[model samples]
Target chain A: MASTIRVRATSNGDITEVQALIQHPMDSGFVKDSKGELIPAHFIQELKFEYNGKDVFVADWGPAVSKDPYVKFSFKGAKKGDDLKISWVDNKGASDTTTAKIS
Target chain B: MTTITGPLATRRLILQGAASVALIGLGNLPFAAQPARAAANDKYPEEAFKQKSEADAIKALYGKTAEPSDKVKLDAPEIAENGGVVPIAVTTTLDKVTSISFFVAENPNALAASYKIPDGTVPSVSNRLKMAKTTNVVAIVEADGKLYSATKEVKVTVGGCGG
Candidate 1:
């Protein structure tokens, strides 16, 4: 299946700045559908970024986060061409994984 | 002009004393018991996120209240035209920052998002959040086992929570 995650990790020898954009409905459950029925909450609960088997950053998000969330963070100790792993799990247990090379 | 240094240093000391006194006036004692918590990195803070009140959410997440601090820099729009995607950012000069969290005062649930910053990660994060209406957006930084916060009011034109 196609990944719903797109990430860019750029390294400046000392720090690796990561920016990710994820596609999700992020339904807060309070919103009503076209039929006037409430849409159940189905937002990403946790998203993690790993580098060299270590967790660099982890985000625990609630439904208040906007749809198609975009987050930016930076970390040290990763060099160019290194693989950075990213993954997330939504409230409904749906998830996606993607890897990006630091450049 | 070099003789002005003597008086400047004395003035700085007086200002520092006044700042502490102001803190006391607000009923916050400096360096109170810090509720050190284990790193529940893999576990989602379900209870905290479900809290409707900001105080309850912070209590549920960190087991403590935060004191307002100038060191925690919160960058947010004064007026968010679209409450659905209000850009929020937080940065701190504090050392040993472990986590940072956002709270929307008027959202259905106050706790919006929390980010864990490992040792190598920078103590800064930027993300978009949903706001139900005009409200105060708070950014809390947990540094060196103590919690400090910064807040700003953001006017929302359109509510994000569906009616």
Candidate 2:
């Protein structure tokens, strides 16, 4: 299956900016299906970014996050051509990981 | 050495069964929560996220209250056409920032997200969140062990019932 996470990181001088979009239902359990059954809450609990063997950023998300979440942030010390690793784990213990190069 | 080993064996035997049971019973106690908090780098903050109000969520997450600060900048839309995906962003000038968090006052659960800002990372975050209705959105920045906050009111046209 294709990776659920898509990330783009770019370096400008001393900082690298990162933007990521992940595919997930992010069900908050408040909505009902067509059958009127409540959709169980399913959302990414955590997402992480690592660079140079160190954690650059970590996001802990709750059900209030929008479906198909999108996030943007930046960090220093990573240069162009460096690898920035991104990963996420959902409430059901499902996880995905991918790496992107800082362009 | 032999005398010490004798007492060591005696104590281990005395503690073996009792200790296991005691630890099991102490789940959710301070003793267990301490270690869980110590290892919170990977632990999902379950209690913090489950809080129903904004103040309760902040207290559960940080165990402290935040003061309004000029150093923190919270950006949110004046009117959200779709409550499911309201763009929110926060940036701080405070030094030694350890984390940032968002809370929606009227959401069923107040905490929307929390971000750990490791050293060398910029203290700015942009993300989308679901809002149940028009409410105050607060951004808290934890820096040097102190919490500072900024708030903005966002009007929502359509509630995020499932969004």
Candidate 3:
């Protein structure tokens, strides 16, 4: 599957900043389609960010979140050439994982 | 030309077999079980998500009241032409920040989004949100076991919910 995440990580002195955009529909189940039927809720329920095998950031989301979520965070203990991985699972049991290198 | 069982019995057996196969298929998918496992131990804040009033949603989520803080900065446009997607950004300089949650007082559901900030991570987040009508948007930050918040009113020229 194509990677659904686009990440940019850069280190400024000691703090390494990470910004990511995830592709998702985030259907809230409240919206109705053209047929006037409620769309079943489909959203990312959990998102985890790891830096060199250590958990750095985690998010628990609901259907209320908007489509194509954007997240930005920074942490210490990460240098250039370090590995940053992000994974997320949706309410429908679909998920995606991607890795990026800190610049 | 053999004796046949009842239709209901046969249907039940077929359903059971299908269910077992579906369960096994889900188990085989690596990511299928991930959310289920986390949800088993995590709280969903059902009441909070269902609330319509801001006060009630905050009460359901935090239980305690939140005090206004200047450290919390909620950035959004003073006037949003479109309510379908209003960009919001929150940043705080509070020590030991734990979580940041957003609430739209006028939406069908008050609690819009909630984010958990892990230790050592910067206490900032940005996302687009849907607004049902022109209303106040609140950002609450939890730090050192205390709740602090900031609020901003966004004027929507066009409603997002077909209004």
On DockQ, the stronger of 1 and 3 is 1
lDDT of 2 by residue, A13-76 (tens): 7999999999999999899999889999999999999998789999999999999999999999
- Candidate 3 local distance difference test against the native: 0.81
Clashing pairs in 3: none
Docking class of predicted structure 3: acceptable
What would the per-residue lDDT of candidate 1 be over residues B1-163, giving only the tens digit for each residue? 7699999999999999999899786673222222223234457887788778888788778988899999999999999999999999999999999999999998989999999999989999999999999999999999998899999999999988889
Error of 3 at B63 (Å): 2.2
What DockQ does predicted model 3 obtain?
Answer: 0.39
Residue range B39-116, candidate 2, lDDT tens digits: 135678887887788887887788778999999999999999999999999999999998999999999999899999
Any runs in candidate 3 off by more than 4 Å, and if so which? Answer: B1-47, B161-163
Shift of residue B11 alpha carbon in model 3, Å: 38
- Residue B21 Cα positional deviation in candidate 1, in Å, after optimal superposition: 47
Q: Which portions of model 1 miss their true places by more than 4 Å? A: B1-41
Q: What do the candidate models score in CA lDDT, each in turn?
A: 0.91, 0.90, 0.81
Report the error of model 2 at residue B8, Å. Answer: 62
